[model samples]
Target: MRIRRVGAYALLLDCGEDEPDVPGRVEAWRAELARRRDRGELDAIEIVPAAATVLLDGVPDPAATARSIAGWTPRPAPVRGTAGVVEVPVTYDGADLPAVAEHWGASVPAVVERLAGTEFRVAFCGFAPGFPYLTGLPAALALPRLPTPRARVPAGSVALAGPYAGIYPTASPGGWLLVGRTGLVLFDVAADPPARLTPGTRVRLAPA
Candidate 1:
């Protein structure tokens, strides 16, 4: 792992070139980092896990922290406790649903079947608060983003763009190809956790 100082408060840990087929490696690293932080070895306020990068936030000195953490290797850790599987129901009747099905030479039902068949993990939350960027989408269902972003994508919009699937937590502009919609509220300010999803949670999409 190569660590680099990105800014005053951020240290970027580059987990080498991304392994296209091994998403578990990234997830393992994330779990390890979270463990280290909880043990008080690292004073990170936020840990952002991406496909090939793990960003540590709220470091006193980015350069010093990067140098120190670079020497330490991470161990594989299993997700435990409340951070387990979360099933969500989806309605496969989006505006772009037919177009995506046509692109893959499959029916809408076929596309939905493939999506609901696999279990995806919450890789990270970004783009919008509580909006989990889920990994493990089937390769056949991996579609490109829209040519133009929508003016407003409603909350609970289940979309797939590139290799990631995500549900919009709130109404926002987005470019992802919408395949379905969910009735469940993903983000709620009134709630304790606010966001329904978190990193390390396994999510299964089901037909509503």
Candidate 2:
């Protein structure tokens, strides 16, 4: 892990070296930082995780804090139990369902079964509000983004790209391969937290 200064008051952790296990690393770092903060060893307002980096914002002494955690080894992300996993019921019929199945050299039922069997966790939120970039898909199953992004991917469209699975929270342009959809309301403007799928939220897709 390498720490780079971000402007005057923040630091960014470049986790490029741990690309394959970035999400787990992010989870581990966040937990460690929070633990340190609780013990009065660190101070930061936010511990945000992205595709490959974790941003430490509102830190009083960025350099010192960075140095403190520089030598610290990252632990594996904790596994959440079934009771804590959010189940999103999905209708396994999408425009790109056949394409995704073909890419895996598997039948539609096989693909659906595989996805339903795995657990996912929100790695970050980007592209749109409440749109979660989930991590769980193995490296062997990684796929490229759509060459021609859809003009407006409908809300709740369960999609995948690279090693992540995602859901379109709102109707918007997107490039991820659609494999299914859910009726779950991902976003609500008036809600306390607004987005249902925040970073670290565990999820499971169930066939409707």
Candidate 3:
């Protein structure tokens, strides 16, 4: 793992190239950092994890933190406690269902079975407000982004692209292959946290 010092107050741990297939490792790192801070081993710092990176912001000393992270080995999947998993109800009736099934070489029902059966984790939140870039889709099922971006995708659209499954929190243009949708309010400006899917949260796509 390579640590890139972000200015003077943060360190970005690039776990991308080293562990391309295992994003849960990033979650492990985040959990460890939070554990350190909570136990008074680390100073006040924010542990923000992405697809394959964790950004430690508000670092008291970058070098010290880097050395500390470097000294530890990363753990495997099953990111955290069971309480973190959020069940998401999807309709499994996206317009792209046939296409996705064709790509997977499976029947429509079989595709739905595969999706609903997987346990997913929120690796990061990006692309839009409350939009979660979830991991857990196997590499063999990875698909490329749409050749032409859509002008607008409705809120609660559950989609997939390139080893990631995502939920569109609000209406906006996107390119991911839409396979289903949910009714849950994934984002609301008036909400306490605003975003329903924070990084490190677990997810399951349940057929609604």
Candidate 4:
């Protein structure tokens, strides 16, 4: 890992390189930082994670925080206690469903089976609030984003691009292929946590 200063209040830990399992490593660190922040080990205001980096925001001492993070080793998936795994019910009836099956040389049912069978983890939130970029999709299911992104993708759209599977928390523009739709509300600002799928949360896709 490489640590670098981001302006005055943040330290960015770059996990470096793209391995098939980089998302898992990033999730582990993101959880660890949360633990530290809660215990007063870190006085940062925000711990934001991405595919390959964790940004520690509002830190009092960037250098010291970087040193601490450097010495730390990644642990197994964090204990979320009662918040555990979230099951998302999806209706596999997307516009790209048939195309995706053709790309994979599999039938539509096979594609749905593969999607429902694999488990995914929330690596980070980006693009939009409460929109999580989930990792752990089987590599065989990975595909490139649409060449021409739709002007607007409806909320609750279950989409896939590369090795990530994500739910469209709110209606907006997106390029990920829509493979399904879910009824679960992924984002609600008035709710306790706002985001249903916070970082470190595990997810399962079930047929609705």
Give each model's clash number: 0, 0, 0, 0
Tens digit per residue, CA lDDT, model 3, 74-143: 5554436657679999999998888899999999999899999998888888888899998887889998
Model 2, runs deviating above 4 Å: 17-20, 38-40
Candidate order by lDDT, decreasing, is 4, 2, 3, 1
- Pairs with steric clashes in candidate 2: none
* Clash pairs, model 3 backbone: none
- Per-residue lDDT of 1-208 in model 1, one digit per residue for the tens? 6777777799887767655554566677788778878988777888888777888889877776666676767676554543556879999888888988898898988889988887888988888899998988666657889999999999899998988999998999999999899999998899988989988788989888
The digit string of per-residue lDDT tens for model 4 on 51-153 reads: 7988889999888888887888867874454366788999999999988898889999999998898777888998999998988766666899999999999
Candidate 3 wrongly placed segments (more than 4 Å): 18-20, 77-83
Query: Scored by CA lDDT, what does every candidate get?
Result: 0.83, 0.86, 0.86, 0.87
lDDT of 2 by residue, 1-208 (tens): 7799998899998777556677787767766776777888888988888877888899998888888888777666665569889999999998888888888889999999989998988888988888899888888888888998989988999999988899999899999999999989999999978999988788999988
> 1 or 2, which is superior by lDDT?
2
Residue 189 lDDT in model 3? 95
Q: Which pairs clash inside model 4?
A: none
| Residue 35 in model 3: lDDT | 75
